[model samples]
Target: MKYLEWRINGFLEAVNFCRFFDLGYNGNRFTWERCRNTQNWVLERLNRALATRDWQNNFPNAKVFPVESASSDHAGIFLTLGVNVICYAAKPFWFENFWMKEIDIKQAVQTTWEHGKGQPIAEMIKSCVAYLLEWGKNKKQQFKAKLKQAKAQMTRYRNSSNPYHLQSFNSAKEAHLQALEQQNIYWKQRAKQHG
Candidate 1:
């Protein structure tokens, strides 16, 4: 009991210091689990993720979920940063400003350029454009799928009656909100490019 009290005090102090709240999560509830058959098992939430009020405002849909640990004693955490994935009409080719900041961008561009060398100028441009388009399409699809999954999970939490699920509902909602925000940013940037 003394140890438990000490832990509780420490937790309260940490929470106060950070000015953050727990991000609701779905999936495994406990981060730490140890068991040997049905005779004995211990479970505890040893690990957690917290977000500030500012972070909550910025990403209302952010969530942190525990994934299967497999061989490990502790579960892995999955954080959703909130991005809305939608099926949009095909967009025109345009370079993304963020791509310039990627360390591999130079290498990827150089590789594409090398592959297109010795071809006619128009054909070379076409090759590079095709490569870039394919790359972008794949990346977008991956992001879209992840966002969709997070949204679906949030919906599930909303429909449930379990107290734990209800508690997590807010966190899930926040993650969804974050995804919407991401969509807003994506369109805003695209609009800026056209403007």
Candidate 2:
């Protein structure tokens, strides 16, 4: 979703999407406040996960936000599937990779040449630009692959019988949910460190 959201912005700058979070585990067992205590911890772990796939680099707006963990010890994760995923667009995000395409990191290097790009630290802009490009490429790749797989799965379901079709539909949904959980495990593990 983050990949999709980033691609969405590629073509349409205004394209934006949001996801809400509970910030806690099973609501019955824990409370949001307890989860709040772990915000720093959770984000610290999440940062590593996001870094693993270079996710944040690609989708600038797509992020994991904390509210009040509420009702559960698990801090809720507000993740917006990036780019086209949130918008659910039929068309793919079309854009060229400028820096890598040219094999020239001049503009990328020159980014810091302009002051105010990173006020606190002039080197910050360099890091941001580098991160953005790295993640952007990966995000684009992920987006295309995900989109293709979804299209294929949908086509298969469309061709099958009613029962199998429904089953396939449900199976696909379950798969997605599982994927989301797996993706979120990075942060989950981070929270566990406190234990």
Best candidate, TM-score: 1
Candidate 1 structure quality by residue, lDDT tens digits, 45-69: 8777888989889988887887542
Span of 10 residues, lowest total lDDT, candidate 1:
95-104
lDDT of 2 by residue, 95-182 (tens): 2332233334455445444543645574666565555556557654654465346435644673345787767766764554433443
Q: What lDDT would candidate 1 get against the real structure?
A: 0.70
Candidate 2 off by > 4 Å: 1-120, 170-195
The deviation in Å at residue 96 for candidate 1 is 25
* TM of each candidate vs. truth: 0.39, 0.27
- Return the number of clashes found in candidate 1: 8
Residue 168 lDDT (model 2): 73
The alpha-carbon deviation from the true structure for residue 174 of candidate 1, after best TM-score superposition, in angstroms, is 34
Collision count for each candidate, in order: 8, 22
In candidate 1, the residue pairs with backbone N, CA or C atoms under 3 Å apart (3 or more residues apart, or in different chains) clash, namely 60-174, 61-174, 61-175, 61-176, 62-174, 62-175, 82-179, 83-179
Give Cα distance to truth, residue 26, candidate 1, Å: 1.0
Local distance difference test scores for all models: 0.70, 0.44
